[model samples]
Each structure stands twice: as structure tokens, then as C-alpha cells.
Target chain A: MTFVNVGTLGTQPGQREAVVAILTRANPQLAQAGCLLYEVGTSEESPDTVFVTELWTSAEAHQESLQLPSVREAIAEAMPLLNGQMSGFQYQISGSPLRD
Target chain B: MTFVNVGTLGTQPGQREAVVAILTRANPQLAQAGCLLYEVGTSEESPDTVFVTELWTSAEAHQESLQLPSVREAIAEAMPLLNGQMSGFQYQISGSPLRD
Candidate 1:
């Protein structure tokens, strides 16, 4: 089943753009790891937060990606920029109008 | 520039599956209207809420889609199944490494 992860990363004042940069950086490894879609954006309503939406082949693909060296490095690079206020939710994709 | 919308719709008790059904029904009209991605999902963290993530060629495309008869009809069908709680955020694409 396809797994979806939607979440926000809260950054310290003025650190939002930096986090967005890190998360949005190109990494071919993501697709090889089963990522279908990986989007990083910033919302007008929440200037301090960066919004991310991801689609993976499976829940396991997402979990295993966390242990990847490059992913770990990216997380390390982004952690300090964060404010520790993160909120998100994950789900298995049941369907899509276009895909159906 | 790409436009992204990430949001959640809170459904009436036990109406989640129904709402999901409505949101995920096949709609080729969405693509003709410039929708790149339109995903409907449900999260374990918030059982009553349905998550939606969308990507559009432009913000204008998304706004215009609302005026579409099919889109309006879909909204009407979904409104009653909802519990009046909705939270979402929209953003204009800055950049993405994958897309870059």
C-alpha cells in the first residue's frame, strides 16, 4: 500500500527558509528509496512553519529512509534550525481521483 | 510556479469513509483544469479528519476549479458529511531540489 506523510516543521524566527532549503535539496536517493512525491513548501498562514507532503511506496519505505545515512545527515542539518514544535499526520493512501 | 494546498477536513462521526469516497471519485475534469496532483487520505492520528494534498500549475487554476460545475457539485456532496472543522494552508512554490 502507498504511504503518505503530511507534516509541518516549525522553525525558529526567520529560520523557516533555511529549513525549507535543506528539506527541498535534491537527492536522487529519495526516488531510489521509493519516494513517489516529496514536496517542501512554506505557507502564508504559517510563516514560521515549512509544510511537507510525501508519498512513498509503503510505510516501510518511509521508515527505512530515516535510517539512510544521507537522510540522517539531512536531519542533523535541519534539527538546529527547527523550533521543536512539529505537528503532522501519516496515512496509507486509499485512492485518488486522477489515479483512479 | 506551482501552487500547493495541504489541508484536513473533519467529518461527521463515521462519515470519514464516505467523505473519502467522494473526494477520491474519478474526476478527469480536475486534470483538464490544470491540477497536477489531488490526493485524499485519512490519518490514524486523527481518525475523524481526512487529509488532502494538492498541487496545481498555478494558484489561479485551483481557484478556477472551484467554479467548475463538477467541482461545485463535489463540494456540495462533501459539505454535509463534514463537521464544519477544516484546517489548511496554501503556498506558492519557492523551489524543490527534485524538481530543480
Candidate 2:
């Protein structure tokens, strides 16, 4: 089954740019891997909160991405920029997961 | 290669049961469709917030689910039970969409 991870990035005040920068620098490396989609965007309702959504070919692939040197470094660099808690869940694609 | 829709369901106070009830009622019907993975769960930190994550075989499948008579009816029935705005985004599974 395909795996997906849904999470949020809580950026500290005035640190949005740095967080995005970290993502920008990290995306290409992530894209080069087994990651099918690795994207980060701002929440429409909450500017301080960022939405991160991903789809991986397999659960193993998802686990491997965490070890990427660049991925870890970039995220570590952005850690100080965060304000609130970042959380996520893993799922096995079942069917059409949307309504419309 | 695959399409994913990430969104949330905002249930009004004391209406969590109504929302889950709605989803519980609609899931079997959703599973009968082209949906590959369809499930709902509560957030670990915020009991009031619900997180929905789905991976559809295609965007078309995602759209079709909306038209399902039961699906539509269920979501509509649960509308009044919502407290905050529910929003989502669509993505093409790019790679392994996660870190280890």
C-alpha cells in the first residue's frame, strides 16, 4: 500500500522566511529521492501554521527519507524557527480519499 | 502518478459523536468505491480537531466520491456539527513523501 504523511510546521514569529528557506533548500534533495510528492504551503486560515503533505511509494521509502543528510540538516536548521508543536500521521491508501 | 487530497473536518462543540457517526456511516460506502484508502481519526494533541488524510488512485476518483449519494448526504448531515473552517489541498504523489 502507498503511504502518506500529514503534518504541520509551526513557525515562530517573524521566522516564516527562514522556515520556507529551509524547505526550499531541502525540496530538491527530497524530490530526487523516492518521495513522490514533498510540498510545504501556508495554511489559509492560520498564517503561522504551515501544512506539509507527502505521498511515498512505500512505507520503507518514507522511512529512508528521514536519514538523508540534507533532509536532517535542513530540518534541524529550521527547528529554532518553529513556535508550536509539529505532528503527523501515517496512512495506507485505501481508495479515493476525497469527496469531490 | 497518484492523487491525494488532504483536509480536515471541524466539528462543533459536543458534536464529535455526530461527526464520527457521520463518517462511520459513510465509510463503508466510500470503501465500496474506487477509494484505495479511507479512514478517519482524532488528533493526538487536540481532541476537538479531526484529521483526514486520503490517497486516491486519481483525481477523478476523488471527484467521484463527492457525488456518491450516501457520501454527500452524510457530509451535509454533519455540516451543522462543524465549529471551525475545514480546508484541504490536492497533491500528486511525487516520491516517498516522508522522512524516516
Candidate 3:
């Protein structure tokens, strides 16, 4: 059972664009690190919010990916644009919300 | 920002004590759907691999506490002990890998 790392980001009210830029630029690095899917999206109702969803092969694989210099650098770059504490979880997918 | 729903649960090796007793009895319906911190943890070198962490606030008040009904009958009785395909996201926290 692989792990999916899900995260939600809250930016500085109007700093959504900067956040998106950071995330978009960082996606390739994640992909190269065996990320099954990586996306950073904005909410229609909440303009200041950003959502990050990722699927990785395993916890160890995800950790190995994070150890890459590019991942570290990208995260460092994103750190400033963020506002509050980063909270997240790496889950094993208990149920599929998909209907297809 | 108020959104933190990170989950990682993989069972069936040893059932992880009945999935931690259905996540400790569903953690008070996710602490009245206003959960600040809910934890069901155990990973000393990965024992059947179960780790679920939550801290919810926004997201329409966690979807209005999942529309009650006893949290959908404790998630339909743990969806028959779960297996796979449940990916999760929903984050507002950006970076707080607490070190204190």
C-alpha cells in the first residue's frame, strides 16, 4: 500500500499567484521523484487558499524524494510565501471516493 | 486557513487492532467536527502501518460535521475493515514540522 501526501496551504490573502508559481515550478521535481500525481489548485470560493495533493509509491519513497536537493530548494522557496503552520498527513487510502 | 485533514491507514497485516477500534471510536465524531487535534497513531518501525492525524476547522466546518447521523454510522462501520483507494487532501497549514 502506497501513501498519498495531502496538504492544504493558506497563503497571505492576496499572495495566491506567488504561491502557485512556486508550486507549479516545483511539480516537475516531484514528478521526477516518483510522484504519481501532483497538483496545486485554488479554491473558487476561497481565493486565499491553495490545495496540494500528491500521490507517492510509499512512505519511504516519498521520504527519499523529499531528500532531493531540488525538493528542498523548492520548499524553501515556498516557505516565505506561506502564512501559517503547514499541516498534513501521509495516508494509505482507506476508501476510494472515485465513482468510476 | 483552518483545514487539516491528513490521513494514512493501511491495514490487513494484523488489522492494527481493529483499525484502532475504528479510529478510537471515530474520535468523538471528529471532536464534534470542530476537531483541533485527533490522533490514532502507532508506527514503531511500521507495525501494519497505521497513522491517522487530523485537525479540522474550516471546509464548511468539516462539511458540517459530516452531516451528523453519528458520523454516517461510524463511516459505515469502517467500511468493512477497509482495504484501499482512499486518498486524502484538504490543507491550510503550510509549514510547521514542529521541533519543540
The TM-scores, one per candidate, come to 0.92, 0.54, 0.50
lDDT of 3 by residue, A10-82 (tens): 7886888788776666345566666765546565666777777566666777889878887788779887788
Give all candidates' CA lDDT scores.
Answer: 0.88, 0.65, 0.62
Give me the runs in candidate 3 sitting further than 4 Å from their true place: A94-100, B1-100
- Model 3, residue B4: distance off in Å is 15
- Which candidate leads the pack in lDDT? 1
lDDT of 2 by residue, B17-85 (tens): 557656655356665666665555554444555556766777788888899888788778888888867
Docking class of 3: incorrect
Tell me what TM-score chain A of model 1 achieves.
0.96
Tens-place lDDT per residue, model 2, A11-100, is 887776567656755355565666776656554455666667766777788888889898888778888889867765665543333332
Computed on C-alpha atoms, the DockQ of candidate 1 is: 0.67
Error of 1 at B8 (Å): 1.3
lDDT of 3 by residue, B1-100 (tens): 5565656666667777677666566345556567765445554555665666455667677778777887677667665666764544555644221111
TM-score of chain B of 3: 0.30
